[model samples]
Target: MSDKNDSATVLPEVTFSTFVLSLASSALVHLGEVPNPETGNTSRNEALARNAIDVLTMLDDKTRNGLTPEESKLMRDVLYELRMKFVARS
Candidate 1:
């Protein structure tokens, strides 16, 4: 049936690596638009870091391909540092 064929035509599941990469790319692009409270300037770096944290939080062990435990820990640390900086600046 046409419906069956359409279902079969759907794209395959996305790998974790691909998903992460896509999320990272999108976050980087949006980072420039995030507003800074103090100077009223855009803080792209901070935004990117925050986005990364959000993405990581959504990732699970099965969805964290290509990232080792060390890398995950590093990302968390970086996110924490950025959040602190943002709070301090504000």
Candidate 2:
């Protein structure tokens, strides 16, 4: 039998879309829209949420015309959804 960590989980592949989604997820957590996976609690912190959203926006701007269509759309959609949540929480 091989000695290996059977409980080790595989990580998701890194891609522009996945990166965008991760950032959006963080924004959602900060907005108290999604529970923190680590704590199983939701709490609003507009500053952190806005910072995450802003970082996403900046990433999109800096990567314009450099991403695949799907990636671009993913970024746009994630930003839109996060923005709406941020607004609602405000």
Candidate 3:
């Protein structure tokens, strides 16, 4: 069972939304917006950030018409936030 408090003992359940958020987290890390969980470092790598954004964009494109309304909205909102952050970083 996934436990929020005992993360070392269990991971979050796999789901489309979680997957998208995972990728977005990685993108944020690359953008130096969020610290790396393991290293406690924040570093920018625009190429990698753009790559993640592209992958998420592709996901949004490919998953269109297939996702629940909530899932779709999450994707759109995350992408929008990431893009705006990326622009500001640049």
Candidate 4:
């Protein structure tokens, strides 16, 4: 018989912070800052990256004061880094 505890193990639940990070990572990949894991290729798509960054910025603004400290910082840092990369690529 299997242990009941084995069935209790669960994957990490997705949160706002994780969702934001996911988008930031995608933008980085599109900007060629990070390589595509599956294709082993880096491609620059400033238009798409910029759009993703804009979406993040809008989310941050809309969710201001609602996020936990860590969540807020993560979003801010990701946005800042992505913006810098976008400018450097431009």
2 versus 3: better lDDT goes to = 3
Q: Model 1, range 30-82, lDDT digits (tens) per residue?
A: 46434444566664565555666576566644345757786666555544554
| Per-residue C-alpha lDDT of model 2 across residues 1-90, encoded as one tens digit per residue | 434785476668888777888988899899998899999998989999999999999999999989989888888889898888889889
Query: What are the clash counts of all predictions, listed in order?
Result: 0, 0, 0, 0
Model 4 TM:
0.82
| Residue 64 lDDT in candidate 1 | 56
Off by over 4 Å in 3: 1-8
TM accuracy, model 3: 0.89
RMSD of each: 9.0, 3.3, 3.7, 4.9
lDDT (Cα) of model 3: 0.95
Which parts of model 2 are misplaced by more than 4 Å? 1-7
Q: Can you tell me which runs of candidate 1 are displaced by over 4 Å? A: 1-13, 33-52, 60-90
Error of 3 at 70 (Å): 0.5
By TM-score, how accurate is candidate 2?
A: 0.89
Winner of 1 and 2 under lDDT: 2
- lDDT per residue (tens digit) for residues 6-72 in model 4: 8887655688977998899889999998998889899999889999999999999999989999988
Weakest 10 consecutive residues, lDDT, candidate 4? 9-18
Residue 34 local lDDT, model 2 = 84
User: Which pairs clash in model 3?
Assistant: none
C-alpha lDDT of all candidate models, in order: 0.55, 0.90, 0.95, 0.90
